[model samples]
Structure formats: structure tokens, C-alpha cells
Target: MEINLNKHISGQFNVELEQIRNDVLKMGGLVEQQLTNALNAVNNFDHDLAKQVLENDIHVNKMEVKIDEACTRIIAKRQPAASDLRLVLAIIKTITDLERIGDEAERIARVALESFNKAQQEFLVSMDNMGRKATTMLHDVLDAFARMDVDAAFEVHQSDKALDKEYEGITRQLMTYMMEDPRSIPKVMDVLWSVRSLERIGDRCQNISEYIIYFVKGKDVRHTSEDDIKENVL
Candidate 1:
């Protein structure tokens, strides 16, 4: 009889762990969709869509709060230890990063709306590409976390180098535009700010990847080389 009861209790604990994992994934999905929508709004110059993205940020913030509260309750009541503690801690950290990503996307959309009248097609295309790349990085990092895939998480960090290169290119182009035409200076500055926000988003994605590595391997991979990541982390 005691053995059966122990088995049942173990099953219940497993179910709770699954529930926490699902909640984190759902939060990630919401943030990803927000980023996609924000980019679409910028590309299409849709003021209404931008407004919608801004409005939905409130929902993301609420989810972050609720998830944090739930995680706290689980820790206090369940008294999870070791790997279980690591998993819960990772969820808490990831959701915080996801919520910030949502805020960055919303800020970009707001900037898009403000400069919609002045923005040129060429600049808009570049910004859209950057947004897409950043969002893809975010999605991949979340996937890595969900599966505890260290290789996939490392991919996100490598991809961030590409994002940095793109951001530098955009910055150079914007600087040239501002220097060549005095009349274009103000609008170019707005575009520069938008691109800067996107670059920061990429940095956050890299941070998320590092967190995933830590969660899986119990090692901090931040500021570490790819070779070191493999040699030390693996």
C-alpha cells in the first residue's frame, strides 16, 4: 500500500513539472507572436497594427507577473531541490527575459508608427529584416530551453554574431544618409534608434541562450568562445 502511494505522489509531481514547462512555452510563444506582429506593422506602415502590438504588451507583462507568482508558490510548497530547482529557476529567468523582449518589440512598433510618414522603403526593408532575424533567434533559444538542447542554444549565440554585423552595417548606412543630406537627419535618427533597439533585442537573445546552457549543463557560458563552450560546457 505504501509503495502504491509513493508511486502516485511521484506521478503528481511529474505532472506539476510538465505544467510549469507548458506555461513557460506558452509565454515564449506569446512574445514571439508579438515580435512578428510588430515587424509586420512596421513593414506595412499599419498604425492600427502597431497600436495592437502596444496594447498586447500589457498582457505579456501580466503573464510575467503571474508566472513569477506561480513559481514562487511551487518553490515554497513543493520544496523542490537540485535539478528540479534548476528547472524552476530557469523558467523564472526565461520569462523575465521574454517579457523584456516583448517590451522591446512594442517600443520598436511605437517608433515605427511615429516615423511612418517619414520613413523610406529602403530603410523599412532593412529594419524588417533585422526584426525577423532577432525574432528567429528568440524562438530558437526558447526551443533550446524547452528541450534542454545545448547545441541548439549554442547556435543562438553564434547567430548573434551575425546580428551584430547587420546592426553595424545599418548604423553605417544611417550615418552616411544623415551626413549626405541635412534634410534627412531627423528621420534618419529615428531609423537609427529603431535599429539600435533591434540590436539590443539580439543581445537579449544571446543572453537567453547563455541561460539555456546554464540550465542544461550547470555552467555559465557567457563571454565564452564556441570552442570553450564545447570543451568546458560539454
Candidate 2:
């Protein structure tokens, strides 16, 4: 991915920055596919696929450590200022969020191993829509990060509220099921945890989008109102 920022005169410094960004993208790709496989495992009751996703999380953790070290080295040796410093900080924050996203995906995959009855199956399937929404948000935010596109970042940030609504709806339905059939409570709770994981993944994706905005606009949009963020970016 090409960074649109100004290139430094020192070739080595530029290469170091570029490498960190590329590594972040690589980590993001792994986490994205991990989430997809985890979602598929739950939807299809594929035990082997879920196991694979769990195993692959180590790679995600490793990548996060590697990228974080790279960012630290740049900060210590190169001493980047302004946009460069923001870029490195963004990379550090993005990788941490990505790693947490990986953890959430792993949690969802674990639910696939549980035995759910036919009645509980619909609840699991109901989460598919929210899973897909979270995955799409992740994909878009990663794309925006690569291109440093503030507009795309803003759009992803705005789309998170819809995902939240979906989460709430599914949660309410699951609670109703738990109340009606006490026997299904165990399995339904499993699905509920998975649904919560997907919702958390969407939140992390939003955090990544905020990092993208911070890197490009140099504004800490965290805890800021959506309207305030819109005014800053636009």
C-alpha cells in the first residue's frame, strides 16, 4: 500500500516507515481471514475450521509484537515528528486493536465446538448478519488505513451504529429464547457470547478507523461526538 505522505530525505528512514505500514497491513489480512473462518465455522458447525482459527491466533500475536518493536525502534532512532510520529503511533494503536480483534475471533470460533440443538441453531444463524457486517467494516477500515482515506474512515465510523442495533436485536431475541426454554439456556448462552464477540469486533474496527483519522488529520477523535468528528474530517 502506498502512503500518500511526504517522503523523507533519508532513504533508510523512509524504508523503515514503509516496512512498519506493510507489516500492519499483513497482520490485518491474517486477522480478517481468521474472522471470516471463525464466522464460517459457527455458521456451518465446522469443528476443524474453528480449531484452525484458534491455532492461527499465535501468528497474529507474533505480528503485533514485531510491528510494535519496529515502531519503537523508529521512534528511538529516527525521532519522527508531526505526521511521521502520528503515523508510527497509529501503527502501534492499530496493531493492538487488530490483535484484540483476533482474540474476539478466537472466542467466536470456540462457540463452534459447543453442541447446540435445532432450536438453538437459529440463534447462531441469526448472528451471521452481524458477523458479516463486522467483517465488512473491518475490510473497509483496513482499506481506508492503507489509502489514508479520511472519507472512507468517516463512513466506517458512522456505520458502526447500525451494527450496534443489530447486536441489540439479536441479544433481545436470544434472551427471549432463554426465558421460554430453560433447558436451552446453556447453548443459547454460547450463541450469545459469540454474538457479543462479533459486536466487540465491530467496536475494534471503529477504533482502527479512528486511528486512521488521527494519522491523516492529526486529530484525536476518540471520545468525540460523531458530529464533531465529521466537522473535523470534512
Candidate 3:
């Protein structure tokens, strides 16, 4: 199963690397679609759609497992070092985050369905915005990975700030409503969970961006400042 970098170095290794990249991109695409569908389910208050999202989560999970196994096999057989090893490791880490993002989407969909009977229209609008932002971030992160565009990946990292601001704004508005009328507590709680789920999804996008940086530059940028990350973006 070993692939010697020195022997047949020109053609076979290049093709193998391309296959790895394509496989990772395929997995990323599936996770992106799941996030999009989950967001739509939340915004429309479509319990049937939400149920479908929940059921299809198993597929996403299976994809994650398969991708991880593929990466493991490549690393074991290819004995990739330096950049190649980093790319394989990044795919492994990124897929884990993507799978978690899918899990979060499913959690939000479940909450949306559970509150379908009681959710108020006023709160749905804010939740819809949160869902949109989360899905957009996920999409951007996956695109960055597919292209290995460091600048685009950094853009995805910085974009988390907006999602956080939106979540904070929603929190304040919901708190105001709850304070004005204690009867809004239950609905507000559901909205809180939905917003939290979206916020977590944004955080996962940041994780993906970090993995992108590591894959490209062999650096760990997590917990680092934006200025530092921007400086490293090439």
C-alpha cells in the first residue's frame, strides 16, 4: 500500500493528492448542503423539513467516518511528510468540525420542530437571520478549503465577529421581551437555544479556518489575534 514519493514521483503522486483533495471537497459539499437545509427548516418552521434534516444527519455522520478512514489510510500508506502530511491532517480535523456543524444544525432543527406549535412570529425573524448567517459562514469556509485560499479563509474567520454581534443583539431583544412580559419566557428560551446553536456553528467555521491556515502555512493560529492572522495570510 506504500506510495514512494521518489519512484513514479511525477504522475502517480500528483494524481493521488488530487484524489485526496477531491474527496475532502466532496465531504465539505455534503456538510454545506446539510447546513443550508437545516437553516431553511428553521426559518420556515417546517417540522417535516426539520424531521428530514434530522433523519439525514446519519448520512453526514457516515461521510465523516469514511473521510477519516480515507485520510488515515493515505497517511499510513503514503507516509506523507511536511505539506502532504499537513493537508491530510487538516482534512481529518476539518471533517470533524464539519460533522459537528452538521450535528449543531440537527440540534437547531430539532428545537425548531419542538417549538413549532408555540414559536411566535416575532422571534422567528431573528432566528431566521441567525440561521442565514450560520449557513453563509459554513459555505464560505468550505469554499476556502476547496480553493486553499488563505485570504478567503481569513475572511471566513473574521466573519465570525458579525455572527457573534447578531447573536448578542438577538439576546438583548429577546431579554427585553421577556422582561416586559414574563409570559414570553418559554418562547424566549427556545429562541435562545436556536441562537446559541447558530453561534456555535459560527465558532466551528472559525475552527475550519484555523485548519486551513495550518494546512497551508504549517502554523497554529487558534486563539491568535486577527492582526496576527492577517499578517500570516498569503
Q: lDDT: which candidate is best?
A: 2
Q: Write the per-residue lDDT of candidate 3 for residues 101-206, one digit (tens) a residue.
A: 8888887777657553444667768888778888888889888887887888999999999999999999999998899889878877887887898899999999
Every model's TM-score:
0.90, 0.98, 0.89
TM-score order of candidates, best first?
2, 1, 3
Q: Evaluated with TM-score, which candidate comes out highest?
A: 2
Instruction: For candidate 2, give the lDDT of residue 98.
Output: 98
Q: Model 3, which residues run further than 4 Å from truth?
A: 1-13, 115-119
Candidate 3 has its poorest 10 consecutive residues by lDDT at 1-10
lDDT of 3: 0.81
**TM-score of model number 2:** 0.98
Q: What lDDT does candidate 3 reach at residue 171?
A: 96
Candidate 2 residue-wise lDDT at 167: 94
1 or 3: which has the higher TM-score? 1
Question: For candidate 3, what is the TM-score?
Answer: 0.89
Model 2 residue-pair collision total: 0
Q: Give the 10-residue window scoring lowest on summed lDDT in candidate 2.
A: 1-10
Candidate 2 residue lDDT tens string, 1-234: 588766888988888888889999999999999999999999999999999999999999999999999999999998999999999999999999999999999999999998877767888878888999999999999999899998999899999999999999999998998899898888888888888998998899999989988998889999999998877655
Residue 227 lDDT in model 1? 88
